[model samples]
Target: MSQTKIGALQIGSALSSSKVTIQKVLDYESQIKDEACELIVLPEALIGGYPKGWDFGTRIGYRKEVGREQFLHYWNQTVNLQTDDLKDIRQMAKRTQTNLIIGVIEKVRSSLYCTTAFISNQGELNGVHRKLMPTASERLIWAQGDGSTMPLIKTENLKAGSVICWENYMPLLRSHMYSKDLNLWCASTVDDREIWQASMRHIAYEGRMFLISACQYLGSPSSLGFDTEWPDDKELIRGGSVIVSPMGEVLAGPIYGEEKLLSAEINLDDVIKARYDFDASGHYSRPDIFKLNVDQEERIKN
Candidate 1:
């Protein structure tokens, strides 16, 4: 593994529009075709719209009919794991000659999992990483992921692994990937705050791996066709997508308030050099003092 170019996609929210969002993704990919980004990452739930303000009417401690209806609509808007929609995405990655890590709301019967699909350069779906835990109100809409799908996927030159949104804060999950000797760490998130950005830097510094934190730069609700309570002055999600080096240096950007393509050149040797003294999962481990047990079996869907 030598030097590689990685880029993060910081785009606006598409609401419930998967087709349009995917088209925009392809368009952006085309725009950066010349940049030759070996690894391209998109924000969390890019295909299946990230609902920013739906409470699902659980405030009364009961599921309301209106909330059920909203759930139905959100469910209808999502793409199934086994479908032509995903097939098309794989084809696009193959055509662009680049590996992709895209966040999407994956449909499994009546449940939706916040997931990121890993597509290799050969245009094949490598695997998917579902969010292990949905934060706060997200629990109302998304389901918890099982451990079976949390393995590191090896690409041509990069050992890739992903953790959606707040799960990046999970020390055990980070250790799991670190144990695998990950070269590329993808944090597909909806968080746009400075705290999230800080986590990216810390993860890069801790793991000694290239980190790509992809976050959305969404605008007002009127444009994306969502019902909201916040004023126009407030942003739904200000993009802060960034690419950090193994030494935790900001190599690309922490772009915000706008849509942009953030790119950076990464040297695999740097990862090696950075790990010479501190390898979180390597010689730095204390297996006798700490143990992490994981379940890598895919959860059986009923």
Candidate 2:
């Protein structure tokens, strides 16, 4: 039974500056070096920074010019794929000897998407999974992702996949990942509630896989080094990062109200043990009774 240490970085904030945020991420990784973590999951929008409590001057489909202005500001902050931003992360992953699942706002020319980049330990920018659907106000800033990036990474030890934020609630998507037999599922979210905790454990039990979720520990809008309508006593996002075993047990944390770098040891053998009776993609599945076809055709256009 091989054990892998998984690190969940829950100390992200609204820096908006990729250079600063990337430095902060490197600092956190340095602090976790003693843990010898093989895999690290960062919070969603860690680079672009989660947009909390802003209306963009929109009302009932009426968008003002200021909304356009705000979007341009966001666009400027987004990291371009063919640039130094991702290149630096890839190098960082290689140096640390750790696989990284980093969430960022990806810019491809005039468009932007909420994306998660999977960097291999060898410094390869393996793949990027953009959010399939933007939730609520997020649609204002991010474009929809296609099925092209909906696949898992087969690493040396465990197969990895990701579901960003509310997208975890999608049943068909879950079946898709389950079909791939992913053992290490990375969930990067901004959800700061108890219900999401249950969702993580439930997904782990359902898929018979080890799950790790990383959430941002963002202070109130003002404290986040930005201006917002939130009160002085408010903590915008209170960090509910956690890790779950294949048998639906909590291994690490639901750390709150503070910045934290949390880690937990996971035995890949537990996944096999838990799935002895139910392998969602194999003996436990009624493939003849039900079938799901995924189209991974590239849809990006100039």
TM-score to true structure, per model = 0.96, 0.95
Q: Which 10 consecutive positions of candidate 1 have the poorest summed lDDT?
A: 224-233
lDDT (10s digit) by residue, model 1, range 86-117: 77768878877888898999998888999999
Residue 97 displacement in candidate 1 (angstroms):
0.3
Please tell me which predicted candidate would have the highest lDDT against the true structure: 1
Q: Cα lDDT of all candidates, in order?
A: 0.86, 0.85
Report lDDT (Cα) of residue 205, candidate 2.
96
Count clashing residue pairs in model 2: 0
Clashes of each: 2, 0
lDDT string, candidate 2, 155-261, tens digits: 77878998999999999999998998899889999999999999999999999999999998888766666666778669888999999999999999989988788
